[model samples]
Every structure is written in structure tokens, then in C-alpha cells.
Target: MKQTTMNRTQRTVCTVLAAAALAAGLSACAPLIVGGAVVGGVMAVDRRTAGTQIEDEGIELRAANRIRETFGDRVHVNVTSYNRQALLTGEVPNAQERQAVEQLVSQVENVRSVVNDLTITTFSSTLSQRSNDTFITGKVRASLVDAQDISANSFKVVTERNVVYLMGRVSQREANRATEIARGVSGVSKVVRVFEIVSEEELRRIAPQPAPVTTDDTKPSGG
Candidate 1:
């Protein structure tokens, strides 16, 4: 009963956080979803190693800082890193700024590669558009959570200009399944996959192991 109660609390907390993020319209994109066993379940089911996760976070921060330092408010870019692969989205004034932004992100420490999807547009996305994108991101995340067959936590979702960008280490089967699900969401104009494809065997190899249960009979004797 206690375990069940804890699970319910965790879910409620995650739901509230997700709602808050949506309301704020933060650029971090997808609202965190509670999935699988418990809260923090998203990170638990993530394919990246703990070290890789830290590195990815650092890559994003450093890249964003570099872009801001270099271009100031002239260019609008969103850097999302998964498995050390950095994805650049949003708008730039021209082709030259787009290439420059990509170069800056690529120079960030530990970035394995970069996918530049920045549109060459003079005008950046407006507040209303960004709000809609945030809404779309939340809807897509919720749909992924609803799908029992595929692990929603495996994918990192980002939306810009109504295009949904998916990043993760997933098998072809999982990638296709996620794409279909993302496309079915109402506000998604397009879905761009940035997945690092792995074999099912590889996925199994990296899957999180279950914690060992301790019984009273197996308790170690005190010294």
C-alpha cells in the first residue's frame, strides 16, 4: 500500500511539473512525462549512460552560451544534445549565419556531430507560434506516454516551427513507431528523426537491470 501511494505521489508531482513547463513556454521543448515504473522513470529508461547524459547536458549549455556570446540576439537558435549529437534548430538571418551557428556548436566540448536544421529567415518565430510549438511538444509527449508498446522515455523531443525533432538511441522498429505516433499528433507539421539507430540486441545489452531484492533470510550477519 505504501509503495502504491508513493507511485501515485510521484506521478502527481511529475504531472504538475509538466504542466508548469507548458504554461511557461520554455524553449527546453518537450514537457517531462512520467512513464513506466515511477517518476524519474524517463531518465531511468533513457538509453544514454549516466556519463553520456551529463556530457549531453554540458554540451547544450556550452553550445548555447557560445552562440549567445557570438551572435547575441541577432540569431535565434536552440541546441539540443542527445548521445553527444547536437541538433541546431530555429532561425538565422541567412545561410552564412546558419553555417556560423553550426560551427560554433560543433566546437563545443564532447559534441560528436551536429544536425543543422536552422531556417534561413530574417524574422524569428513569434510568441504565439512558440506557444503553439510548446503545446504540440506536450501533446506528442503525452501520446508517446500513452503508447504501451514503445518506451516513451527513449526519445528526446524538440519542436520548432511546427516541426518535431526526435533524438535517441533506438532501433529501427522503435524509431518508426515513434515517427508514426508523432505524425498523428494534430499540430505537428513535420517530424524529423535524429535517432542513432541501434540493433535490438544492443538495446537489450544497455537496458537497465532490475535491482536485486533482499529477503530477511538473505540478510548479511552483523560483524
Candidate 2:
């Protein structure tokens, strides 16, 4: 009875920890504690290292908080970070506001570069338009996943007002393929590639190597 109770307690603790990790966006722990299929699917499919993924999340959150505090609702901006590079999308009231947002994002820790895709316009997008952009982004991601040649995990897709922004560390061929796939998605007005291009050889080097196979010799020879 004591053993059974101990086992049940352990299981409950593990369940709680896994839930906490998922809620906190601790991708590294999610795969191990929870089933990989449930909480860590994105982390597993992502090409970025676990550390880089966490850093990217941090950069986005920090930049977003700063922007909101500075501009309130006067400017609408969406920030995405991949491999320490930031992409700023959406509408700003003027060129000065656009440049200011970019400068602020660049100052964020761990943000190595910034792609200022902010359009200088009079007003921000409506809720319905933002919803459409979300749908478009989901479609692009699904298309990339379905493409045989492209690794969906290698690309991060973002959409604002029908414009799709693709960010990743990928080879030229992969980048082109992803762009074509995103462009083909319905309702995507434009496809912008913010890729850090790497050569085939470099990709090979960075890719995880397969473990060596070992054969068991204990089986008796056939008669």
C-alpha cells in the first residue's frame, strides 16, 4: 500500500510539473516531462536550439512590452524573433514612429538584427483584418509542413495585413521553396523572406548527426 501511494504521488508531481512547464513556455522541459506529442511538438519540429527558442521568446516579449508602454494604442506592431533577429510588422502612424519602434527593438538584449517592415499609415488594422491575417499565417504554416522538400520547423511565419513574413536560418534552396509555398497560400498578399542564408555544406555541418548502428552478434548461426 505504501509503495502504491508513493508511486501515485510521484505521478501527480510529474503531471503538475509538466503542466507548469507548458504554461511557462519552458520548451526544453516539456519534451522530457510531458509526452513529446502533446506540449513539445513545436519545440521538436523547430530547427532552433532549445536555448535559442527561449531567447527568441524573451526578445519578443520584452520588445512588445516596451512598445506598448511607449505608444499605447496609437501604434499597432507585431514583433517576432528568430535566432536573435527581430522582425517588426504592422502599421505605425508615421515614418518617425516606425523608425522609433525599430530603434527601440534593436536596443533589446539578445536582438542581433531588426527587420523594419512597419508601414507608415494613418491607422492600425481592424480586428477583422487581424483575424484574417492570423488565418493566413496558419495556412502558410500548414502549406510549409505539407511541402516535401521544405522543413516546416526551419521557418517561422508571421502575417500582418495579408503580408507574410518568413524568418529562419536556412539554405537558399529551402528559403526559396518556403517563400514559394507561402506565396501560393490563399490570401497572402506578399511574402517577405528574412532568412539568414547558409550554404549546403554549412547546413550539413549544423544538422544533427545520426547515431551509429550496432548489430547484436549473440544470435546463433542458422543451420
Candidate 3:
């Protein structure tokens, strides 16, 4: 009984750790729990192709680094990339700074387009406000996951202040459903759809198919 209890405790600890890791966006560990695919599992479910997903991540990181080097705390910005299109949110001290930031982001490699949503404001958001925004993003994501008709993995949720920005490659139905779900979430002031709209036929063509399960029937009979 003691051994069984110890095993149960160890399993619970590992489960908690895995959940924390996933919440922190360390999705490479997904294969351990969801079968063997590494990051490929996530890519498979995402609306974007694996190459596009990788490129988007690279685009966001490079753009962010450039913004930091160029502005150096003169502006507050959050960069989100989906399907190689960049969305710039948060605040800037002035209009000139906002324009400059948009141009700077546009120059980042492989960024197909830029959506400048930077507010020209005198003050940046406080840490508490930013924390609240993060909480709102998580809540929106959870709500989407709970939604029956939507494939939550298809949408990327980013929150700034009280606004929720959604990015995805989805059909009109999927996009509308996702937007409605996001808007209905508590504390979400607005929903901005930055989706790469695809037709249902195109979405079906690009969607990843489930891997086939195989069974080994050649095992020798045991005595």
C-alpha cells in the first residue's frame, strides 16, 4: 500500500510539472504525454504549416530584438506573428514613434505584412495592467478550448490592455466563431481578427490528417 501511494504521489508531481511546462509554452514536451511527435504535434494541429509556424516565430523574435535595440524603453510594444504577418500592439510616446516602430517591424525578414495597432499615448501600461492582460488572454484561450465547434489550436490569442487580438488561417465560419467566443469572454473589451481567411475547401486541403494507428500481429505465441 505504501509503495502504491508513493507511486501515485510521484505521478501527480510529474503531471503538475508537465502542465506548468506546457502553460509556459514549452510545447516541445508535448510528445511525452501526447505520443511521439515533439513540436510536430503542435504544428500538426495548427492551421499554419510547420515551416510557416517556424518562420512566424523567427519573425516575431527578430522584430522584437530590433525594436528593443532601436527604442530602448522609449516605447512599449508587443509583437505577435502568425502566417508571417506581424501585429504590433501596446503603446508609444508619440505618433512619430508609432510610425517608426511600424516601419522597423516591417523591415524584419519574412514578415509579409504589418498591422500597426500601436496607440499614441503619453504613458505605457503599468505592470499590474500588463498582468491583467495576460490573465485575460489565458481566460480567452480556455474559453475557446471549451467551445464545441471551434478548433482552439487554430487561433493565436494575444491581449493588450483589454483588447484581444486573434490570428489564424481559418475559414470564415471558424473565424466568426472564434471572434464571437473571444468577445464573449469576461474583461475582453474588443476582438480584432487578423486572420488569413481561407475558403473551406482550401482549409480542408491544408488541414493535417490524423496519423494511422498500427498493430503488430506477428508476435510469437507465448506459453
Best by lDDT: 1
Per-residue lDDT of candidate 1, residues 60-105 (tens digit): 9999989999999999999999999999999999999999999889
Where in model 1 is the C-alpha error above 4 Å?
1-43, 218-223
* Residue lDDT tens for model 3, 138-192: 7787677666687776778888999999988899999999999899989999999
Relative to the true structure, how large is the alpha-carbon lDDT of every model? 0.84, 0.79, 0.81
Off by over 4 Å in 3: 1-23, 27-44, 221-223
- Residue 10 of model 3, lDDT score: 86
Runs of candidate 2 with Cα error greater than 4 angstroms are: 1-45, 210-223
List per-candidate RMSD values in Å.
6.2, 10.5, 5.6
Q: How does model 2 score by TM-score?
A: 0.76
Best TM-score among the predictions, by candidate number: 3
How many pairs of residues collide in each model?
0, 0, 0
Q: With candidate 3 superimposed using the best TM-score fit, by how many Å does residue 207's alpha carbon deviate from the native?
A: 0.9
- By summed lDDT, the worst window of 10 consecutive residues in model 1 runs over 33-42
